[model samples]
Target chain A: MGNADSLLQAEGLSRDYEHYNAVQDYQLTLKRGEILGLLGPNGAGKSTTLRMLSGTLAPSRGAISIKGIDLLQQPRRAKQSLGYLPDQPPLYFDLTVEEYLGYCGRLRGIRKADVEPAIQRVIKTCSLEEVQKRLISHLSLGYQQRVGIAQAIIHEPDLVILDEPTKGLDPIQINAIRDLIRNLAEQHAVILSTHILSEVEAVCNRVQIINQGQIVHESQLGIQEPDKVFFQLHLARPPETAQIEALQGVESVIAQDKGRYLISVENAQAGLQIVTSAIIQNNWGLLGLCPQHESLEQTFMQKVFQEDRP
Target chain B: MIGLITRFEYRRLFLSPLAWTLIAGLQFILALLFLVFLENFITELQPRLALIDDAPGATDTVITPMLIWAGILWLAVIPLLTMRSFSEERLYQRQALLMSSPISISEIVMGKYLGLLLFLATALSPTLLTAVSLSTGTQLDWGKLIAGFMGLYLMLASFSAAGLFLSTLSRQPAMAAALSYGLLALLFVFYITGKTQGSESVLFIYLSHFGHFLNLSSGLVYSSDILYFLLFSTGFIILTIQRLDSDRRNG
Candidate 1:
């Protein structure tokens, strides 16, 4: 079931192979104007989930609703609201960029009268103006990617799903695409899947890390305040672990060898003040204190690799 | 939506040089055959033209044979033309685009079928026009010409449908073409068996398309013959749609 405010909602989504699950019990909800990034390694079910969302693949069990329309029951109507760019851009090399985009617009059920204007809008938005007349096969890789995006958004769908939108591109083109995605999210609920973490930090507001066909971690990107903060401190004479744990903002304190203490603080700024004051009052000489953050890269690696540990 | 797909397919086929080249080559070959047959008729059958009350004229002696030759040509060419319908999409991984679109599988199959039919009709037009032009110089039977054309059109439609169906089964266009040829050859082989003992095996003669196609070409329009063509084309088209639906479900 979709919430009134949700632009897209999926529940209990699962796709199964003969003996393995490709994706299992996946849930997602995206509000209008929100960009959700799906991050995962190869064969981690990001593409499979996106394919199901785009109505191209049937899930073994799931319910997907786009703008209050059920995907399985009314696929055509539901798909009318979706725009998808597969991991490999599905392009017709023989057609010109303009012609290809026009076909895409009509393929999405855009009105005949509206297809021309829609093509023009996507072409301009994707920066495909200069090569609109050129055959897709003749264009450079960057331009082909642009044309791929143009085709996806030509129908002005409410939900845009992109898989590896910037898989292979120079830094300059990547930046341009990042900006274009930001603009697209202003009007549509966008779900972007990529292996690149920087892309999520640069364009996505929220990120989900998928591992072994399941979402293992999800968090907001570029938030001002961290959810949990860690600190590594060395002391000449360390206090007891309970003494540190008793501090106002301290969540946990673990003793390390060689007179080191590891503290988890719920609020780093306030905890820094309390811990420091307590250390000074107790006369336990604070050798060094460094605040540590769990970056997205670390979180991703931990979640993906932690399962491998016995 | 189906109309849009059909129109889009037609434009794509027209823009491709392969379709044009095939049409031009067929026209050239038919023209040469036309002249050679017309010369043969003038020399051998001119004196006997008025001997019987009803005798074979230009439409029979020349046009019908020419159409049969064109029919044989289509056996090879239609497979090439229709091989790319879905096979190329699979080869380039562009099936995602069409499969992801909101259109139903039936619409996609019908669109490709109609598009290829239009292209085949355009390619066969020049040869038909040449046969029509024979009336200006000598007596011609419009009924026989039309029946022959209807037979040719039906055969092309069936061949193209089978080829399109084969295309959905493989990603390699050449392999699709080969499979389509194999199917047509199977049909022809069955027809050849029936020919060995004319009318002895009613089942074999009726099962093969050759007897029915020849029946129609000789100005015999049986409802059964038309039904055979319709069922042949529709059966393959339905199979193609079902194949796509299964791929979506399974993949």
Candidate 2:
């Protein structure tokens, strides 16, 4: 009841299964029109938290509220506000895409008058027009994913929680899902939990990294640079061993086999000019100079290992 | 809201070849068993009545409306109809979708149990038609026969609910079916053994499923039997709801 304004809120949520803590001391908030990316490795409790928020699960010790409706008490009301896409899509293989969406819409409490339009909107929005009449079992993995998203939005819920929505998708399918999610954010809040860090950057506005049942770090997209960069120097000839060490703020330079050196630097600007100029002045033919910002993968590793240290 | 959801569930179940085969096959097998029982009952009745001399005026009240075979056939079919009610959903991950929906636990549990019960009753219609056809052969105690049918309905309803409660406890369909079979076997064997020894030997016989089947089998309309079966069905349904709720909360 205290969290009526937020689209979804888990305050001090925790769940234990057979005496083992699945998710401990977890807190997340999804406001309207926002997409929150929950990132974590396998067994890190990403799915557990998503289950709790979706009302498929209830926390052992916490409050999950949707627009101020307490899920533990008024579950039906809270559930009406949530649309969840689990890692495995809960689709009936025998039903066609259109029939599946129609069933889902009704289950979510959509009025009879709106069932048709709701299904149509999601079909078009998810680009499921081609396979709308095909049986779910016959569709490819990518199209199945689209059907999952379509069902999640059929009732136009306030919060759409997609867990591994792009899992097992090809590059083209991944692009389609990314676009679909971006479009979904316009009408409802979205939270997509994934181990693929790049997915968060592409579609989500904010991200939280969880490890071993707890959130370790959270950052908003485009808020700040990733704080470190790598300069991959392609040289016609290997530079002097001390040359990389002499540069300001250069952490280390390791030979990456066959005349390439992975030069780690404190930031992008400091290493960019220094490495390029150093190559030219030293008469080392510079085949290429590439900058590597902290990709989501690296940040994931950084957080995971940092938390592991005693 | 629950009806609409359950109707959709029925449509889905109808499309599954596994579901169709079971429902259709049960009907086919029951028809065969009914014919065999009718022939055997008539044959045995003739010999037993011969000892009464030439008095054809004797009332065949007990032997005409033979429903023991019909009742036995129903016991075998109802549990199969309901054994996968919740187990298959969990196996395929569809239960998660249902649990997360804007429906109460009671609605979901009752909807599934009724859905299976409806399918089972549809299969029983032919058997009822056969009973009507047999009425031409002799005078039937129609009032008692109807009472027996009512008892069969409630008895199957109770068995189906017990199966459904077991289904919700496990994700494996075979395990769920085995569990219901195990419980049924205990009631059939132990109840008979105890009744033969002494009624007081096993007071638990009062709760045995077959004990409830007896009132209907013998064409005796006892309000206590009706109330017992109704309570049995309702009690297990409540158990199923709580089990699902626990699964949801524990996750």
Candidate 3:
């Protein structure tokens, strides 16, 4: 969705804590306007990775570059194009929304003359106009989260890193923040860590699931994998497992209910005719037949709990 | 970037009532001490004038005591004011906001130090009023008063720098404040040890800050004394910067 030049490129990023490696050999390349979802379980080093990317925590080894500028060597120059929000919104409780945003803009090297206009732009974009004059301590959790995002974008950074952007919020607030994040991606490349699978599906263009400090899976959205598709069938008289297993392109069969079974197919379109024909010819009295696409939950569980795999 | 951080910190200091309360409460105590010293000076003035050709004037007797009271007040007040400088941000997990910005750690430390210095300057301004008001009726030694205030400023700057360094060491604001006060007290009491250990021990005399401040408070503006304060405060500020830089590597 962007040009050939990626906005963020991190290679071989790793952090060691004397006893174990928190994050190991991490790699990422994000283009402009791409929403990359970082999916991981607890103790998966997601926050540690984000912290290293943001320059808050130094990596034990490896290198990160933002817009082709080395993060470690030219941090000040590289940070100009980066904005990061940690897991908790870092707000100065005594300052109002406008005051805090203004401070953030100038701290990021925004010109004094341009700070006000930039703050106004983010206030409008984050829908924080009403609470612009209210102290952050007085605002609700949702508005505080909005203010957090507003500070990140106040400098108009090209790469925005958010660690658990929607960690705590009601359903409506989460939806609002999700929409705001999607809107942010129109101008900035966003990388957010979240536990909400639905949120990733709704807003992310690409997802990378990490387990045990490694990227276990990565895929782009809207492209279905037919090879992994399976079918669920209910019948009055089900056939033997060996009979279904003998059919061409069928991987396995498992009995589910009194007369139901889940059939794993190598290819959904090609295996459909063979499995249905066998069931009908056997007089199994097929009552229901439907494709069951694998959900991200299954993929996440499989990736996290598979002990033998790295 | 340093200026931006300084302004933000100043705003925070302005909003917190703790700063105002400390300043106001100290001013009240100094004023009360001023009256007591003035009454004692007035009662013994005539006897001293009759006995000696040049008696100690109001600046020597009254202003000096008031300045000493100001010093004592600051020994306690500076720590209270600077307790939340870097420690509070760390405690609240907001250090990332400043550390991750383009601004360097030295700039952050300088900005915080300057912000607290400005607040201390303003908070202690009223104590100078007590010294200046003596000009209306009695002779005031302007040079001595200036030197005394200069000493107070230097002492307060060193205290603030030390407090700032201690703040960087701990995440709890109260612990920072207590440690700073305890350290300052330890330094203050070294004067007694310096006397007992004799004049040959340069380390005890120099480390305490007692002799240097005394020289300045007595209107003796020796370059050596000024240099001592300058280097002392700079040492603490440098220590603070070093600690903050290490956090980047350690975190």
Candidate 4:
């Protein structure tokens, strides 16, 4: 069931080839104004999941509702509310950028009278004004990719599904595309798949890390609150590990070479006060104290490698 | 939706030089054939026409053979024209644009098919015009000419449909073209084999598209021939739609 703001709802989604399952029981609920990033390794079914959600690939078993319209039962209506950009930009190299966008507008059921305005709107949005008259094949990879995005958003659909929108771009181009994607998400619910962790961190509001055809972890970006805090403690004279672990609120203390200790604590403020006061009371010098933040890369690696272990 | 796709496909075809080159080459060859047929009709057949009552006129002596040559030429040309209909899209992974759109599979297939037909018609226009130009100098058998044109068009439609279906079966455009050429040639073989066995080999003759096409080209308008082309084209078009639908499912 989808709520009013829910733009996409997929449940029990799975796809399989004859010999192996590609995606298994994938589920997602995307709300308006949210950028949901699908992060996975190569061959991890990120594209397959995006394809199924976009109505381009039928799931062997699943249900998908785009804007509350059943994709399987009423695909025409459901697909009208969403636009998709596959891994490769579905561009016809023979057509000029403007002509291709017009064709895409018409294909998306935009009225003949409104097609020009729609083309202008996406061309402007995608920053394709200068090359609008040039053939797509003549443009660089970045512009061709922008044209791909232009087609996807031409009809101003409520949802946009893109598979690896920033796959083969340079850093500057990737940033530009990310900005364009951010602009799109302001009015459309965006779901993009990528193997780049920083891409998810930079542009997505939430992320799902998939591995071996299953979602291993899902979390809201920038809001993950770990139960324990970690700190790298450097000291002129470090206390024994048992003495530090005996302190209240200090979870674990592992000694390192040259008087450094990796410390985990139950609470940041209280645990820091307790540990520092104990060190001062014991005459152990505190050379430096720094908090270590856990990055998404760590989580990704942990989830993916953890799943691969027998 | 179908109209939009058809227009796009048709324009896309013209944007490429392949279609233009094919059209020009076909016209040039047909023009040479037309001149040869006309020269024979004038220098060899015209003098004898007065002695034979109701002998075949320029329509049979010139236009019929010219149209027959055009038909055979198109048997090769149609595959080249229709080979990229679906195969190139799949090869480039551009079918996602249509597959993800709100349009149905049948609409996509029909739109591409009709677009190829539109191109075929354009390619055949000069030949048709040359045939029609004969009316200015001689009394043309309009009935036979019309029947021949209709038969050629029907045969081409069948060829294009089969070509389009084969295009869906493979991502390689060349492979699709070769497969379509082979399939059409097999039907021609059926006609040849059936002819050697005489009309008594009703099954092969009936199954051969060339036999039915020949009937129409000879100014015979049998419903059976019309039904055959219709069934052949429709069957292939439906198979194309089903193939695309299965691709979505199986992908």
**Can you list each candidate's DockQ?**
0.66, 0.55, 0.61, 0.74
lDDT (tens digit, per residue) of candidate 1 on B1-251: 77877888888887889888888888898899999999988998867886877777888889988988898887778888888999998887688888778988898889888888887787888988899899889778888889999998998888788899999999999999999889888888788887785546667777777888888888889999999999989999999999988888888
DockQ measured for candidate 1: 0.66
How well is each residue in A1-310 modelled by candidate 2, as lDDT tens digits? Answer: 4554577878899888886898899987778878899999899999998988888887888888888888888888888988888888888889999999998898899988999999998898888999999999999988888888788888888889999999878999899889878887887899999987778988888999999888888878865665677778778887775876787778888888777888888777866777777778888888877876556777888899877999
lDDT of 2 at B138: 69
User: lDDT per prediction?
Assistant: 0.88, 0.79, 0.85, 0.90
Model 4 global lDDT (CA atoms, 0 to 1)? 0.90
Deviation from native of the Cα of residue B160 in model 1, angstroms: 0.7
User: Distance (Å) between predicted and true CA of A274, model 2?
Assistant: 16
- List the lowest-lDDT window of 10 residues for candidate 4 chain A: A219-228
Model 2 Cα shift for residue A296 (angstroms): 2.8
Candidate topping DockQ: 4
Model 3 agreement with the true structure over B1-251: per-residue lDDT tens digits: 77777777777897988878887888998999888888878787755765887777888888887887788777877787788888988886688888778888889998998888787778778888888998997878999999999998898888788999999889999999999989987887777677773454667778887788877888889998888888878999999999887787777
Between candidates 1 and 4, which one is better according to lDDT? Answer: 4
Model 3 per-residue lDDT at B81: 74
Give a tens-digit lDDT track for model 3, residues A169-204: 778878888898888889889999987788888889
Pairs of residues at least 3 apart in sequence or in different chains that clash in candidate 4:
none
The deviation in Å at residue B173 for candidate 3 is 0.7
Top lDDT: which candidate number?
A: 4
